[model samples]
Structure formats: structure tokens, C-alpha cells
Target: MPRPPARPRLTILDVARDAGVSKTSVSRYFGPERSLLSESMRTRIEASISRLGFYPDRIASSLRGRRTGLIGMLVADMRNPFTVAMIHGAEQACRARGYSLVVCNTDSDDLLEQRHLDVLQGYNVEGLVVNTRGHSVAPLVARFEAGLPMVMVDRHLPGLACDMVGLDNAQAMHLAMTHLAEQGYRKVLMVTPPIPGISSREERTACFESEALLSGLESELFEVDLDNEPARLGERLAGWLDEAPACRGAILTGNGVVNLAVCQALHQLMPAPLERTGLLGIDELEWCALVGPGISTVEQPVGAMGEEAIIRLLTRIEGDAEAPVHRTFEATLNVRGSTARVD
Candidate 1:
């Protein structure tokens, strides 16, 4: 199939000619000085605009030092429900504030993240909401130091002093550990994706380990590549079960993605692994309750967190000179069949 011919670009001069008015009149009609135009002249411009279907070019307007009313977001992975929910919250907040959000999903690719930063910069976005791996923080730091307003969600970069909104990691871990221990589980394994530069996972894993120690439970932390290491996870899980045959063991996932990966590995390793080992996760998913015996989760207020990120970003954009603030939201425990004691 061939592409359709491109239509000629409409210009302000065209609207002025069609309305039988000067280009300055058309400009004033769209500007704050629109009130100065006579009713008859305004009516003529309106009619011409309706007939021509002329939509003002925002980029051209922005080039003249007008605000684009745009906010940019860079996401680490769009596949995760957490990211999607956060994006939803940010988008709603943006709409409510008369600002447009431009989301660029990095797809967990470091190179794309770098490129997206440049693209968002070129557009002169008023602010940014970032949720991604912090391995390459130099660009973000440079931008932040250069006076670009920013807020981080779920993960905070180590050195960048930017506003951050996230769940209280210590409290969340205490909740997860307490529930498992109360359920009569003596041994727990913490599962997560690679946790080097991602601060959220790092905090969750650390807190889980600390909580396990304080609770006097035997614990081990493991990282798995969900894309290619389910079989390895199965092996580790099978070995873990054998390591403590008499005691009931549970798997504590660091986030929603890890929860899914753990389930996949368990299903492949045995007939029904949830019955053998308790399952709990740090993040909640819509389908969590639908799985066999329903997966329990520590639900983070992702939507609210996302909204708070936008709120904080807007404050910065609006000339809030206070220091970068960090806010942590409380997480709740949702008990389900997966975490129950089978015996």
C-alpha cells in the first residue's frame, strides 16, 4: 500500500487571509489580548478556524518562548504492573493540573534511557518523574544540577538529592517477615531480580534479611534472572526444600516481578509448590488473588506514590526552593491462601 500525500502545512497567515483580517489579529485572538478584538472580528476568526480545521502548532508556539505545558516521565520497564499503575497516577495528576505528560519507556535498556533523557530535554519539559534503574545516574545528576525539576518513584539514586516517593522499606519488610513467622514458617528464602543499582530491591532484600535475623528465622537471599533462570530457581528451590525437610519454608519475593518469577519456577519444579512452600510478595498485582490458593502480598500504594511524585515535581517546577524531600508511603499486608500454613 502507498502512503497518502501529505497535506500542506497551515500557517497563521492562511488563517488571517481566510478571515479577511491581519495576521496580528489572528495572533491576538489566540493570545491573552484576545479580549481586545471586536466581537465581529472574533466571530470571523472563529469561523475561519472551524472551516480550515487549523490546530495551533504547539512546537512553533514553544519556539517563541511559550511553555509547552508538558511533563516527561522515564520508566524502567513498562511490562511490570507497578510501573503501569504509577504511570496512570502520574498521568491523571498531570491532566488535573492542565499539564501534558510525555512518557518514554526505556524497556530496561540502559542506552534507551540515556537517549530518552536527551529527547525529553530537547522538548523543554517543565518537570520529570523518573522510575528506573539508577546505574547511569550521571546524566540525571547533571540535569538535576542544571535546574531541571525531578522526582523519583520507588527507587532513589544514591548521590542525587532529588525528591523521592517510595514505600517504607523497613516497615514493609517487618510486615512480610512477621506474617510468615506467625504462620509457623521457620525458614524463608528471599527472591529478587538482580539488585545492584535498583535501590528499591536493595532496600527490600536488606530489610528482609535483617527482619529474618531479628525474628530468629533461618534465611537466604538469592537473585534470579527471570528471563533465563527459572530452571536455576527451580533447582535452588528444590535444594532449599531438601535442606530443611522438617520445617515449613516460604519464599518472600522482593517485588511483583519476582513474585511472578517465583511462581513460574515453582509450578515447573513440582505439582503444586505453593502447598509445599508458603509464597508472599512485596508488591501486589491484580491477578494475584486469582492464582491457585491466592498469592498474598505486601501492597504498596503505587497510585498514590505516583501522584505524590507529580505533586512534588510540580512544586519544584513552581519555584519551591526547599531542599529535596524524600517521602515514604506505608505498605499494607494482604493475606491470602498462598501464605497460609498447609499443615
Candidate 2:
């Protein structure tokens, strides 16, 4: 084999020389104090870094200071569209602030969640964004009490009292219920996953139950077992549809997962005609438009929620000692053919 040329070892010195600035200026450019530098100097340093492809060692930089420039995100289910969108927003915010994100998926498992927490802590991440399964809270509470900067996304941990960024569950349920009622859906069936420990699920379910009565729409709740016999979802859905008064019934899903399951059941029970039965869901999906009659959805501001979570976590990390804030963003309703009234 022919000998290959070795790549040049680039460093701060290289960047400084290339940018015609002192090493201190280059270092400050990468640090939080980059704002202290003139815009011209900052631009030159950025250009120099790009030209030389000189990547700073984050670990080495952390050794010189307390910040590791790493943010940790613990997600309950990475496969969910909402979670994926949130991660994208958080990652963008982190990068814009010159930080990196480390994400761990718990798969809705308590033990796995604890294990991921330990790993994130071991890596000394500057802050954490938790979208937990709400099954276990001991580890999370300990970390929060230990002065670790943390924010909860979508789901809340009992007794932890941390900042949370998520959708307004009450408003979301109200929107769904009101839409169904307006479309002349007098009877509603709300489908969701188990609602034992998850706060979001519980809140949405409770809201639906309470608001349904207030909206003057009779409502029934169904907890689908996604892991066990998912096919039974179709059976239960069929039963509900069969029992509901024709042209006066509708189905509302709690979240994206429930939406997917309900969608599956609807597909299996096709040719039954959805014109008489309306459908609406929280957390919009990409294929909602392609589905039968274009499934109606309450489009959550997922990206904004994620960005806000990062900003809040960073605030805590930067020594904001104020009381915990529970920020909830509103969801927008996207009406489509699914929720249209049948003649």
C-alpha cells in the first residue's frame, strides 16, 4: 500500500495566527465571554475556525472551567414524533448557545431511566431535560435537590418541583371536546394509554372527562394496552362505534401514541365509514393529512416547547434561584375532513 499524508494538527495557535488575533481573543471567542469581543474579531475567529477545521476539545475546555458545554436530555420514548420534534428544537437551541446535547431514551422503563440519569450525571452534564415515564422519582428528586439544573418536558415528576415546559393539557382537551361538540358529535370516546403515573396522560384524561360534561357531550374513556393485545383496541373501538348513535359520535386521542393505536383500529375497521364517526387527536403527525378524511389534530407547539425547556434549564444552570415555573404552551387546532359533520 502507498503511504498516505498525515493531517495537520490544528490548534488555538493556528486559529489565532490565521485570524490575525491573539490566542486569548480566540479562546474568548469560544467561551461565554465572546460577547465581550468586537463583532469583527468574533467574525474573523469564526471564519478562521471554519477554514482550518480546528475543533476545540470540549473536555479540555471544561477542565479549565466549570462548564462542560454539555446538556443532557432524558426522553421517555424516542420513537414518538412529539419527542423527536422536541429533541430537534432543544438541540438547535443548545447549539446556538454553544453547547452540545446528550440524549438518552428510557423506553418508558423506570430502571432504564435511573440508569440513564446515573450516566448523565457521571458525564457531568451542565443541565438535564427530563421527559420521564413518571414511574420513579427518587433519583430525579435527589439530583434536583443536589443543585443540578433540570427541567421537565411534557411529563412532571411527583414531589420533584422542577421547571416544566409542555402543552396546556387542559386547553388541549377543551379544544378537542369543543371541536367535536361543534361538529355535532354529542357522544365522545377518549382513547389513551394507561394513566397511572404519567401526569400528561392523567391531566388530559381528567380534562376530557370534566370538560365533556361542561361541553354537554357524553364521554367515555378507554385505556388501551399497547403492549399486550393491541388488536383488542380495534375490538373496543368497534364496540364504541357500534354503540354510539349514528352521526352523533366522535373519537378523541390523548396523545400521539394513542392517536397511532386509534388510527390502527380505525384502519382495521375500515369500510364501516368514518363519515358518521368523527376523529380528532392531540399531537399532529406527518401522515394525518394522508389518512382517511385527513384526521383532525390539535397541533402542539413542540419545537417551541423544546426550545423553552432548553432555555429554562440553562437559566437554572446559570444560577437562577427563583421559584420553579410551569410554563404551558397552547395547542392549535387543525380542522380537517375527519371532524366534518355528516349530513
Candidate 3:
């Protein structure tokens, strides 16, 4: 069989000729200065573009001394609901500002994060929002020094100073721990993934420990492997339940992943551990409500966080040159059956 003929690539000149307008007018209609064209001209250009199927080449426009109008986002783990929410919020904000977004997922790999950063830089994105495992900051710092506007979302580079937008993790910990305490959970166990270099997890774990002390609640921290070792987590939980004081204990998860792991472990236990111990988590999930005796959570303003990160990056890109601004959003507590007090 013969291959189909290639579609003709339309151009601005064709649209201008078809619309009976000057090339400048067509350019203005396609560029950011569309208001310069008269109403009739605008209508004619729109109709002509529709008829000709002409699409403006953003790359060519960038090459001609125009902004690429693209924002890049690097997410450590795309599967996380929080990252998805952040991307959604950032995309909306970028669209509203007449810019597009290019997202790169690192899958929690340091090498992948470095490569994604290089690729995004090659594209000359107007700005970047980074939510990644900040194990290495040298590359990021080099880019920032070279005048790349950036905002760190939910995690911060250790030595580099940049706009950071995320949940007030300390406040989130306080909310979760205090709620558990109010529910008569005297012994609290905080479960998290490894805290090697991620700032958010470390901050949350520290906050949990400090707040637990202040609240007079006996607390212990547990680090779980992300390789889906539910059996190990369950064994630890079972041991904690057997050793710790009776029905007065609860499990607090550092984030959504840990939350799911903890919940799964509890489900496998014989007596349905939810009936005996309180469970609460940070970063709410869609299934939180559907599970038996819904899981309580401190819901981060993920969408707002993402939007704020973009707004801050845009500001920096627009030449806001003051000290880096760090914005921390407050989390909302949603109480449910899992954290209910047991008499």
C-alpha cells in the first residue's frame, strides 16, 4: 500500500493573504498584541486561521527574540496524588498567563532529576517549579545563578536560596498530632519513607517528634521502605501495638504513600486494627472516604501551593529581585471514623 501524502504546513503569510490583511496585522493577531487589530480584522483572521489550519510555531517565535512562553515543572514522583494536584494547579495558572507548561517526572531518581533539569533548561523555559528529591543541589544552584527563575515546591534545596511554596509542614504536624491527642491517642507512631535528603519529610518528622513531646504524648518514628513491604510494616505495627500501652495509641503517616502502606498493614491484622488504634494521615487521598471507617487526614492545599509556586516564579522571571520569599500554606483537618476516640 502507498503511504498517504504529507499535510501541507500552513504559515502566517498564507493566513494573512487569505484574510485580506497585512502580515503585520496577522502577526499582531497571533502574537500577544492582538488588541492592536481592529474588531473586523480580528474576526477575519480567526476565520482565515480556521480555514487554513495555520498554527503558530512557538519555537520559531522564541528564536526571533520572543519569550518561549513555557514553564517547566519537575516532579519527583508523578504517581503521588499531591504531585498530580500541583501539576493541575500550575498548568491552570500558566494557561491564565498565556504560557504553556512542560512537566518532567523524575520517578524519585537523582540521575533522572539531573537529566530532566538539563532538558528543561535546553528548552529555555521561562521558569521552573521543582518538587523533587533534593539530594544534589549543585546543578540547580548553577542554573539559578545563571538567572533561571525557579520555585521549590514541597521541598527545598539545602544551600540554594529560591522561592519555596508548600504546606506549613510544622503546622500540619501540629494539626495531626494535636487532633490525635484530642482523640485520646496518647501513644503516637509516625511513619515515613526514608529521610535522607528530602526537606519536607525531615521537617514533618521533626515537627511530629517535638509536638508529641509538648503534647505529653509518647511517640516513636518509623521509616518504611517504599518497595511495598506491607508485611514488614505490619510486623512493626503489630509489635508496637503489643508493646505500647493498650487502646490509647495511634499511627500518623508523614505523607500519602506512607498512609496507604500503614492502612494496608492495618487491614491485614486479625482484629481489624482500625477498631483498636486511631489512624490519621497527611496528604489526603481519594480512597480515604471509601475505606472502612474513613481515614482522617490533614489535607494540604495542593492546588493552591502549585498556583502559588507558578505565581512566584513568574514574579521572579518578571524581575522581582528581592530576598527569596517562602510561602507556606496552612492545611485543613478532616476528621473521620478512623481517628474517633475509643473509650
User: lDDT of all the models against the reference?
Assistant: 0.87, 0.86, 0.86
For model 3, the stretches where C-alpha displacement exceeds 4 angstroms are 1-9, 16-48, 228-230, 243-247
Q: What lDDT does candidate 3 reach at residue 83?
A: 92
Give the number of the best model, judged by TM-score: 2
Q: Candidate 1 lDDT, tens digit per residue, 52-139?
A: 9997775777799976678999998998989999999989887766577899999888899999999998988878999988878999
Deviation in Å, model 3, residue 163 alpha carbon: 0.5
> Candidate 3's error at 261, in angstroms?
1.4
User: What root-mean-square deviation over C-alphas does model 1 reach?
Assistant: 5.4
Q: Could you tell which candidate, 1 or 2, scores higher by TM-score?
A: 2
TM-score: model 1 vs. ground truth: 0.84
Task: Report lDDT (Cα) of residue 339, candidate 2.
Answer: 89
**Residue-wise C-alpha lDDT for candidate 3, range 116-136, written one tens digit per residue:** 998998887888899988876
Q: Each prediction's Cα RMSD?
A: 5.4, 2.7, 3.1
Between candidates 1 and 3, the one scoring higher on lDDT is: 1
Candidate 2 stretches greater than 4 Å from native: 1-10, 32-43, 50-53, 245-247
| Candidate 1 vs candidate 2, lDDT winner | 1
Residue pairs with colliding backbones in model 3 are none
Kindly report which residue stretches of model 1 are placed more than 4 angstroms away from their true locations once superposed.
1-54, 243-245
Give the per-residue lDDT digits (tens) of candidate 2, residues 1-343: 9889998778889999999999989877775556678889889999999988888876766677756778999998899899999999999988777678999999988899999999998788888999978778888899889988889998788889899998898998888888888877888888888889888888889999999999998888988778887877888888876766563888888788888878777767866446557889888899989887798999999999999999999888889999999999999999999889744
How many clashes show up per model?
A: 0, 0, 0
TM-scores, all candidates, are: 0.84, 0.91, 0.89
Worst 10 residues of 3 by lDDT: 27-36
